[model samples]
Target: MRKTGAVPVISGAWALPNAPQFSEGIAKAKELCRSAGGTFAVLNVEGEDEQSQSVLETAFRDARSDEWKEFLADCLKFEAEIAKEISIEKFTFAELEEEEQSLERLRRWFRDLKKRDALQLPAAEQAQKALNSCIDSLEAYAQSVYSAQNGGE
Candidate 1:
């Protein structure tokens, strides 16, 4: 979806040794931003969903609340951990396809969630995992596909 005047932000940590690898995986992320003529920042993303957003809103209801900023900082730490568990080059072609399929399932699940506001935290967490898995898979797949099509550099 083309965000209307929306900038691209790479939410997650990018300072550790393996951080560069994660960023490299999503190199197109910057390209995506450029194509859309938007800004890009490699920041951590925490509480991206409604529940977390609510917590933030409640914690600091002030117009200039910094709770959201703090949440993003926490998210960066979490992203670093996730990156340790799964690197950019880890997925295979088959796994990439599986991740893609899983993402589709998540999309359907999230859509269903629209009608139900009482969804459990676990379900929401699972959806997030699926989304991340799909991103990693696609990144690996793109790398492989590009290399193969170019006869491997």
Candidate 2:
């Protein structure tokens, strides 16, 4: 992703009832951003369901309310602490397949989400920014891997 000269922001949500690996997962993702030269952030919010859109919208809006901005600032600090625990690891080929699968899952998720009668994510575009980063990162990573295999031709 760094090869493109475009900055990538790696972000994800740490929803309620978090698993034991949540911190590790976030830290690992942060490490990826670090190695690739990008920003790392997380949204620590409750509930990992469609009902959480309003909360995300408030946080992601262009002119976010002061309260939400402060909340996001706190989340950033928390994410920074989590990032401190990052343990460097190899990016396996299997993980690339997993990332592709996640992209398909994301597609299904958004399709189902739009089928709802009360879809209210006005800042949905803001969310798309993150997805675009993932796509760009995936392509860049694949390119780098291929180049390595080809002896850096």
Candidate 3:
């Protein structure tokens, strides 16, 4: 018997530290689904699924709200502090020349955090623990931006 359920597909472009292009990411996800012998369907928040649409609308709306903007700003401050502690000069969450470079900067910080014996320090420990959260928040912010730009297409 074949499995029957919605298979969640995500594009690598949706990964953190990289700007998300929703149309391209969705296209890639659909292609992956097809190659895996599965069907793909785009979820439209304003479409037939009223309940799901309402939920999505609320969530996206909140994400675009001032609170969300402040949260992202705070996250960026945390990232910058971590970067500075790790000696990553000029570190920024702003889109860089190459997406990979932004990712590499995070990777470098993580590595330095691990190799250093000064994890007992407050700043180092904060930076070490914030790695995952930083990435997650960044990804969410990227998705919010994408949804706004594409009108959740």
Candidate 4:
């Protein structure tokens, strides 16, 4: 989502009544991609009745097109800068007082990437894997600390 050299495809579903908001979301997403120096396409499915199925089918067809495939391939190249900005080792979970803050920061970073829709990139996925590993280590450290403080209760 940080404009890593990729084309992002934003998809959404909305009832006919909320079409305006759905369109706005797509527009905003497009702008975000553009600001990041990338291109974006949108697939907005609208309707609540049987027509909805047809709309979705058409969307599916478009999604399966060669153009969409190229778009996805392009998106895979996105490189998230946060992956380099935050080092997992920096949050070692060594002190009980700092453990919560460390976890919160890691979670916030992860959530920000997700909100920015960067999870689709391979780099983002790698970052997520690293983040999960750090979270696991931190949780284990917290457990050990708790056990030590509470006599393993």
lDDT of each candidate versus the true structure:
0.43, 0.43, 0.44, 0.45
What is the C-alpha lDDT profile of model 4 across 1-153, one tens digit per residue?
A: 212212223442222122332354556767987899987654444458877766644443443343334433432322122222223323223464465565566566555444333224454565566666656655655666666666658
- Alpha-carbon error at 45 in model 3, in Å? 66
Comparing 3 with 4 on TM-score, the higher-scoring candidate is 4
TM-score per candidate: 0.29, 0.37, 0.31, 0.37
Tally clashing residue pairs in candidate 1.
0
What is the per-residue lDDT of model 3 for residues 1-153, given as tens digits with 9 covering 90 to 100? 001111222452111111132355456667888899987665432436888546544443432343324433555775664445335332333442233355456656455333322112344445544556767644554554455556656
- lDDT by residue (53-122, candidate 2, tens digit) is 5554433332223322333343344333223322232244665566567555555544433222122344
Error of 3 at 99 (Å): 7.7
Q: How close is candidate 1 to the true structure, as a TM-score?
A: 0.29
What is the TM-score ranking, best to worst?
2, 4, 3, 1
- Compared with the true structure, model 2 gives a TM-score of 0.37
Worst 10 residues of 3 by lDDT: 1-10
Tens-place lDDT per residue, model 1, 91-148, is 3456545545645554554444322222233434544554565556456565775565
Task: Name the lDDT value of residue 61 in candidate 1.
Answer: 35
Off by over 4 Å in 1: 1-102, 114-120
Candidate 3 regions exceeding 4 Å error are 1-103, 118-125
Check candidate 4 and list the clashing pairs.
none
